[model samples]
Target: MSLVSLILALLVEQARPLPYRRVVFEPLSRLADTLDGMFNAGERGQGVLAWVLGVGGLVLAAGGVFAALSALNPLLAVAWNVLVLYLTMGFRQFSHYYTDIQLALRMDDLPRARQLLAEWRGRPSDGLSSSDVARLSIEAALVGSHRHVFGVLLWFVLLPGPCGAVLYRAAAVFAEHWSRRSEDPAFGDFGGFAKQAFAVIDWLPLRATAAAFAVVGDFEDAVYCWRTQAAQWPDDGLGIVLASGAGALGVRLGMPVVEGGEVADRAELGTGDEADVDFMQSAVGLVWRAIVLWLLLLLLLGLASLVGG
Candidate 1:
């Protein structure tokens, strides 16, 4: 059942990707905002409560629906799983930005590429070079693929039903929204809770993603970088994905970039050639190959289960 639902969800997502702003996610955003207003009392306990209500409420609701439908018919449960996964998982959610940046770089339009990168990341790109843009783009693609696809699938398979996927995505959204420094001062305490919660949730999935990259790409180098450089990045979750991806691609990533006349020195990762326009395609290929590997593993497991039964 898990294998079939995942395969179907991927196919549906590939055929017709969901838009960035959709009705399904709008209510989730509003719910987060509501929770913030109601429970963000600038206290640690309030923050924990808000995180629980925000993440747990959705998971329970989805699980309830799946359970009710499953009581009626097993096919209904499968359909529900597909719908939830389709809404939650897909490469196209972030791939368009990657493709646009690649196209801009290929056309030798560094400015345009920088602008696209800034738009995708919601940050300033004042003095990013062509190499900087390429490296950041590839890094973003790798991390986004993990967050938007592999993590969701892994959670869905781990838990009883679609609830796991919903939990993973909701926690991620909450963490990203609240953990930023630009938010209201009251949210600082709240943001810490969300950030820590997401770290716990994402811990295993990030390593799983790194392992997939290692298996499909350069195993030894990916493992070496995962051990050596993953801790160098500030966020451990993103560090694992980016470090392994950099090694998988056999390219150098992370350097100082002048943003608004400030040079922010980033930790050096991987070892080899510097990133270029052409490596973007390699990154995309790496992600697809990892997806294929995941599906094959699931298929084999399903076959083994059937034989044992």
Candidate 2:
């Protein structure tokens, strides 16, 4: 079932890629916001209530959707999976910005490149060097790939199959979203709660991605970097990705990205980051290699299942 659903979903997704994304998350996001508002009535226990309100809501929602679709028709269930997969798994979510910045760099346009980075991160970019910009862009792309792609795949494999993909995606979104809300006088506790829950959600998959990078990129260096640096990163997943990607490309990737005032998405580049031509090439290679490795692993699991059956 996993193999067939993956194959079918990929075929359909490839055939008709979304032109531009619409707000598929509005309903869920609104639901989360509403519950959080009511339960997060106090500052002290607010974090606890927000987690119960946000994650608890998603678990119920995804399960309900799966149950309803399974009852309606198996094909309908697959369709539901496709909808979630379409939103969850794609590089376009973050890569288009990279492409624009890369184009700017190719023309030797430093300021423009910085602007792109700043806009992405919602920060100003007056101090970035050309190399800094390039390095930061590579790091952001590498991490975004893990969060938006590989992480979702891992979660689905472990849980309620493709529906788990949706759950994983929701978990990621809320984590990033509400965690940032920690700064908000309004939703601060909700954000903090989201942060904790998502940290738990991302713990294993982040390591798995780092391990994948080590195996496919430079086995010794990637592992060495992960062990040495991953422990130091505030977020385990982000640290593992940066360390492994730095080793994979044989470049420095652990430079601190400037944090914007808000709980801005640290998983991406802010403005003023540049991309090295060589590092970009290597980053592309690392991603494709990782993809091949993941597919092979999936294929192996499928084969093992067939043998057992």
Candidate 3:
């Protein structure tokens, strides 16, 4: 049932991607804000409670619905799973931006490419070279693929029903919303809690995605970078995926960039030549291949189960 639902969801997503701004996510965002407003008292305990209420409540509700649907009719439950996965998974949500950036770069339109990158990332792209644009676009694509596809799929397969996917996506959204450094008093003290919770949730999936990159790309280089360079990045999850992907593509990443008069120097990852417009296509291919690998594994497992039965 899990394999079937996942396959169907992937196919449907490819056929018609969901809207970028989903109505389903809006309520989750509002719920996070409500939790922050009501229970965020600038205390550690309060922040923890709010995180639990905001994330756990949603997951529980999703699981309850799946359970009820299963009791009424198994097919209805599968349909619900497909709907949830459609909302949660798929690369098209972010890949469109990636494609636009790639096309702009291919046409020697550096300014347009940088503008697109800035718009997609919500950061300034002033003074970024063509290489900078390529590297950052690749990095963004790799990380986005993990959050939107690999992480969600791992959790969905691990836990029964849609609970795993819901939990992972909810944790990611909450972490992104509340974990930023800020000086607003109403923001409360949940940033640390949100960050730590997401780290715990993402720990296994991050490494798994990295391993997949190694298998599907340059195996030895990917593993070497995964071990040696991942720690250089401040965020552990980002470090793992970026390092692995850079090595896989054999492209240098993490050069210094001047954004808003501030120079942010990132740790270098991967080997060989620096990224260019061509590597953008390589990154996209890498993600699609990873998805194929995942689907193949699931197909094998389903076949094995049938044989055993």
**Would you list the C-alpha lDDT of every candidate in the order shown?**
0.87, 0.70, 0.87
TM-score of 2: 0.83
Candidate 2 displacement at residue 187 in angstroms: 5.2
TM-score of each: 0.95, 0.83, 0.95
Give the C-alpha lDDT of model 3. 0.87
- Name the regions of candidate 1 deviating beyond 4 angstroms: 21-26, 181-184
- Judging by TM-score, tell me the better candidate of 2 and 3: 3
Residue range 1-309, candidate 3, lDDT tens digits: 888898899899889987745655666677888888888777878878988887888789889999999999999999999999998877787788899999999899999998999999999998998989999999999998999899999999998899999999888888877765346676656567887888999999999899999989999999999999999998756899999999998998886788867999778999989899999899888988988898889899989999999
| All models, RMSD in angstroms | 1.7, 4.6, 1.6
TM-score, candidate 1, is 0.95
Q: Which stretches of candidate 2 lie above 4 Å from their native place?
A: 7-29, 43-50, 71-73, 184-191, 256-275
lDDT of 1: 0.87
lDDT (0-100) at residue 127 of candidate 1?
85
Candidate 3 C-alpha error for residue 69, in Å: 1.4
**After TM-score superposition, what is the CA distance of residue 76 in candidate 3 from its true location, in Å?**
1.2
